[model samples]
Target: MQLLALGINHHTAPVALRERVAFPLEKIKPALATLRSIWTSGSPEAAILSTCNRTELYCAVEGKASHETALEWLSDFHGVDVSHLAPHVYALPQSDAVRHAFRVASGLDSMVLGETQILGQLKDAVRTASEAGALGTYLHQLFQRTFAVAKEVRGQTEIGAHSVSMAAAAVRLAERLFEDIARQKVLFIGAGEMIELCATHFAARRPAELVVANRSAERGTRLAERFGGRAIALSELPNRLHEFDIVVSCTASTLPIIGLGAVERALRARRRRPVFMVDLAVPRDIEPEVSALEDIYLYTVDDLGAVVREGNAARQAAVTQAEAIIENRVDHFMQWLDARNVVPVIRSLHTQADEIRRTELDRASKMLARGDDPQVVLAALSQALTNKFMHGPTHALNHARGETRDQLLSLVPTLLRQPER
Candidate 1:
């Protein structure tokens, strides 16, 4: 089986398509189980990495399993038409697959050119695959090497320096909507890492009031207390939504938490005052229809891509350095994969040698059992083992004709070379 990476990312598809294919954290394990079932013949190894910007499947698949099969499987699982999804999908086989994994782990493939969040997301994906029993020797080795390469790139290059984080981009975009962030009351709708990050950036501006609303009130309170703010349950959003001028949401809910009607009510409550809203969730925390509302400035994860892509020009040198490091590691990983190919041949050779030794030892043991001269039996056994070991190469060398003979004449000695004292 060979390594294969096939999927769509922010570079290949729009948010509408990406969100359709995205597997949430809770669904990844089942998705992996289903993918492995599709390739029953290969005993396939599969891992899925799903984030706000991308959803990718990495697999080790054997013969007769092409990208078409995987694409069809994905389309069926997500209920998307193959015709529409195929154009945005990419399939990288063997070395290309290895290279892609390395680049993704090292942050070269992220929408935000040196973002570190993807590495953590990848680790979570790999861990999920492991729990699901989808990670075999090949995929396990691939991710381990991928993580190592990512660490090396981070250590050797300044790719993350001067980088524009999504949180910072959200803040910059919010600044354009409001004259002063300090005068605005901000509500963060999730207490996850992304929410924490957004809170940090927004807090730097010292907003008038900061609040956190989460499904788990305790977790929300803990996160809010960090910024000297109070927490509220998600149930309170409808009643309290209009109180905040800016809202940033990133929750794991599969459905839209903030609908058009809710936002409309909030706008009406504020007498049509403009509410700047950012939805950083994958499936989207806010309804897409809400963007059509006249008095609301709503942005999804895709909307922030342009903002985060800015200010990356100065990091180009570090990007190049990181790419170079990834390429070198990719080559090393491919070499290791190549070595794995010869393992069966090496095993067969050892098996043959062991069989020959057993046959010769049986004959020698019979000689000793019959009371034959001990030294003579020992000599015969030693000679027999040596002859058997050399027989194949000697016969091949003797029978080979012309150039083949010359090649074997040169190769046989190396194959049977003795260790130096």
Candidate 2:
């Protein structure tokens, strides 16, 4: 079987195309099952890692499997145009796949250089695949090593220190717009991890009023209570949006929830007070057109990439250390995979040796049954076994001529060497 990693990410594709190929949370298991079905023989073991910034499919497949087939399946599943995605899609094989997985799990591949959330996302993806019975030895080993590499990178380097995360970046940008964040009202849409993170950062400044708006009031209320804030139904955004100076939204809705008209009305309600908005959702909870309006500052997931990348030069020392750790781990994993290459040959050798042993034992048992002397029969058995073991090499060496004979002469002793006493 061949190891493969195939997908697209922020560097290779724009958000417009990235969102097009995203796999829904509930569809991951079924998608893995379907991915396995395409194989003509036993299904390939597979797992998928889909996050806001990337979607990657890792699989251990038969050599006959086609990369194009897997690519087409992704495009078909997401209702995306294969032609458009083909340009951005990448396929990594063998050691490259091993290295890519290691890099990704270590946070070196994230949009924000050393963010740790990707590691958690990857763990969740692997768990889902395991629960779906889609992971086998090859992929299981690869991911296990990936996690080890990540831990090594984290423990051995300061890669995550001094790095600006998207959540932190949002707060920094908010600070630039408002003189005192503690005096401004902050509203967070959605109760997901990103929202919780942004809320934590905003709450640290003790915003005058903090609110969480979510489709599920129960969840929203739970998160709000933890941060000393209030919860509101998503439906109340139109009326309440005007009260908050900073609005940070991240929801799972496939379409824009906050449109330009909604913001226009909210602006009028505030008498055109400046409002800072961050749309962290992939499909975008807030509409892009809202940025065109005066007295409104709108930012999307892509927009934060630049802000979060600040002080990248300072992180270079940590990056260099982390990369060295990953490189060593990749070498170790590749060596394990390379050892698997000779497994079939090893199995075949055992099978052949076992047959020879059984044949010799049967002959000795028959002679003893015929009333032959035990000592003679045992001696004959040992000689017969030795001759049989040596026959093939003897025949080849004697028959080989010139250079071939010389080569056989040099190799035979090595192949059938006797250990020194």
Candidate 3:
């Protein structure tokens, strides 16, 4: 089987194209099943990772399939044309696929280098695919090793320590407006991983109060409990909008969840008290017009980019070392895969040798049963079995000519020798 990775991310595609190809979390499992069916005939292993920055598909398949086939499948699934996506899509095979996955898991491929959230996102994707029965031995092992490498890289290097994370940058931007984070009432909209991360950082400040609002009250409540906060339904936002000083929202909604009117009401409710808002959502949970309001400090994902770019110079020094490590790991993984590819041939050789052994042994047993000398029968059986196993390769090596003959001569002795102790 061949390993492949096919998708587009922040570097290769703009947000417009990324959004068009993005897979909502709920649709991932069925989508994976469908992808496996389309590519693998019946039994195939596949996983998908879709975040604000990227959407990727990793799979193991039986035969070579055109890269366009996967691209066409994605276009059809998203109800878009293949031509529209061709400019942004990237398809990597075997070693390139392995390297891409390692870079992503290690956060080298993130918009903000050394960001740790992608690792969890990748884990969640693997879990979902496994639950959907779309993950098998090959992919499960691949992801497991990917996670290990990510942990090793982070633990051994200063990659994360010197890098600026989006969450930390959000906190820095919020600090610009509010003198003390502890005095502010923080509100987080949506219970996804990004929101969860922002909440964790904000919670560390021990804000006066923390509130989590979501479409699902249960999920909201569960996340709220972690930070000593309360949960509110999404519908309750308009009435309670102005109560908080800071609002961070990241939802998968295709449209704005918080609009101009809502922020206006909140501003009026707070008597024009300054409010800090961070909208990490892709389609933008908070309307852009809300940023125009006085005393309303709003920042989108793009706005955070500037803040996270500050310490990138320090990270550049570590890039060479990290890349070397990744390259070595990639070569090691490819060697393992090459060994796996030859397993069937090795198994066939063993089976043929066993068959010859059994046939010779049976003839020897019959000679013994007929009262022939047991020693003579055993010697004949051993010689016959040895000749049968060596005949084909020995003949070929003797008949070979030119460079091929030299290569066979070099390999034949090793092939014929007993395995070392």
Candidate 4:
């Protein structure tokens, strides 16, 4: 079996391309099921990890064809142009795939270096795969080890130290737009992990008021209460949109929840006051056309890229330490995989030995029944078993020449050596 990872990430593709290829949280399980059907030859197992920065497919397959099939499947599913995508895609095979997984889990491959969000994202992907029955032996083992390596890296290094996360970056950008973060009223659209993180960062600055607008009141209230913010129903956004100076939206909606018309109405009520907005959703919670309006500072997921990149030089030392740890672990994982290659040969050898033992026992039983002495029968049985066991190796060694002969001579004795007491 072989492991393959194919995808486009923030490093290789622009946000425009990455967004087009992204899989929604609900679509991932079905996407993995489709990949399994397409890669029938290998009884293919797969997982999809799609975040703001990446859309990756990790597959466990058998032959070279699975690699090409995976790429075509992704392009067809996303309806993206392959010619434009091919150059931006990275298709890693075998050891390279393993290394990529380790780096990703360790947060070394994140857009914001050493960010922990991707680890949670990766775990979610694995869970989706497992629920879909799409994660087989190879992939399950890979991700389990990936998580272990992630833990070791986080525990051993300062990789997460001095990191400027996207949530913090969003807050930083809001400070530039407003005179004081403490004086502005902030609205968070969604009660998901990203929104909660953004809420924590904004709440720390003591915003005048904070509100969470979500479809689920229970989830929304729980999140808001943590930071002394109140929850509001998403349907109430149209009437409440004019109340806040800063809005951060990151929901799983496929279409824009905050359309141009809604913003225009909100703007009219505020007498065209400037509002700072961050759209952290992939498909985007806010409409793209809203960005064209006057007195509005609108930023999408891509805008935070440069913001999070600041002070990365200080993280390089920790990155080096994490990479070293990942490299050593990857070597050990590959060695375990390599050791599994001889399982079939070992099974065949055991089968052959069992067949010999049964045949000899049958003959010895007949001899004893025919009134042969027990001592004679036992002697014959032992001699016969030994000769049969040695015959194949002796013949191989005698007929083999040069390197072949030397290998047999060394291997046979080791295979038959006595066990230690």
Best by lDDT: 1
**In candidate 3, what are the lDDT values of residues 1-421, reduced to their tens digit?**
6888999887788665677778888899889878887874535789999988888989888778457778888999998788888888899999999889988998888878888888999999999999998887778878887888888778767777677878889999999888899999999999988889899999999999999999999999999999999999999999998999999999999778999999998899899999999988766688889989999999877678788888777887566667777888889888988887789899998898888888888899999999999889988988897788779988887788999999988887777687879
> Per-residue lDDT for 244 in model 4?
94
| Model 1 lDDT per residue over 80-173, tens place | 9999999999999998999998899888888788889999999999999999999989999999999999999999999888889899999999
lDDT of 1: 0.91
User: How far off is residue 45 in model 3, in Å?
Assistant: 1.5
Error of 2 at 374 (Å): 4.9
TM-score of each: 0.89, 0.90, 0.82, 0.88
- What total of clashing residue pairs does each candidate reach? 0, 0, 0, 0
- Error of model 4, residue 193, in angstroms: 1.3
Pairs that collide, model 1:
none
Per-residue lDDT over 202-247 for candidate 2, one digit per residue giving the tens place of the 0 to 100 score: 9999999999999999999999999999999999888778898999
Writing each residue's lDDT as its tens digit, candidate 4 over 53-123 gives 88899988765635677888888998987887889999998889999999998899987888899999999
Model 1 residue 411 CA deviation (Å) reads 5.3
Better of 2 and 3 by lDDT: 2
Cα lDDT for residue 252, model 3? 95
The prediction achieving the highest TM-score against the true structure is 2
lDDT agreement with native, every candidate: 0.91, 0.89, 0.87, 0.89
Clashing pairs in 2: none
**1 or 4: which has the higher lDDT?**
1
